[model samples]
Target: MNRNKDKAWYIADVGDDLIYIAEKLNTKANSEDYHFENELLMLKEVLETLESLECLKEHSE
Candidate 1:
């Protein structure tokens, strides 16, 4: 098995997980809950980074 492909798949999986968490947070968050907003933002940033990594991995193949 190609390690790079495996790594890319893992990254994509994590990104999907982050997206799910973000969706849940959005549904459960209220206007007063700044913490939830912050968490969602952080998740978005991490997901973006993971997407970039996946793109690079594909290009390197």
Candidate 2:
């Protein structure tokens, strides 16, 4: 399988989980119940990396 396609599929497969985490980050529970800033930051970084990969793939085509 193509690397980019594999990455895309992986992203799609976990899309719901990402959304859930993002929602949590925006909620009062996140502010009062736990310290998830680091994790959320990492998640955002991973998403940025995926976006960069897609952009690079498009330009390199």
Candidate 3:
């Protein structure tokens, strides 16, 4: 007998939350200090997270 487990779909909940916060900060507080840095960091994190998820997806397929 052969058996296979179902794979779970990937979701970026953390990254999406970060993205939403970053977007709001960047747009709502244009003149605030450290806003740019935080936004950039959030974007970087999102990109890295997506990349890792993609790698996992490919491996699972």
Candidate 1, residue 3: how far the Cα is off, in Å: 0.3
Tens digits of per-residue lDDT, candidate 1, 1-61, equal: 5867877676778778787876777766654554666666777777787777778768977
Estimate the lDDT of model 2. Answer: 0.73
Q: What's model 1's lDDT at 34?
A: 48
| Lowest summed lDDT window (length 10), candidate 3 | 1-10
> How do the residues 30-51 of candidate 2 rate in per-residue lDDT, one tens digit apiece?
4666888766786887678677
Per-model TM-score versus the true fold = 0.47, 0.45, 0.55
Where is the poorest 10-residue window by lDDT in model 1? 28-37
In candidate 1, position 3 carries an lDDT of 68
Q: What is the lDDT of candidate 3?
A: 0.61
Task: Report the lDDT of model 1 for residue 11.
Answer: 77
Off by over 4 Å in 3: 1-10, 22-26, 29-34
For all candidates, the clash counts are: 0, 0, 0
Q: Residue 36 in candidate 3 has what lDDT? A: 62
**Model 1 local distance difference test score:** 0.73
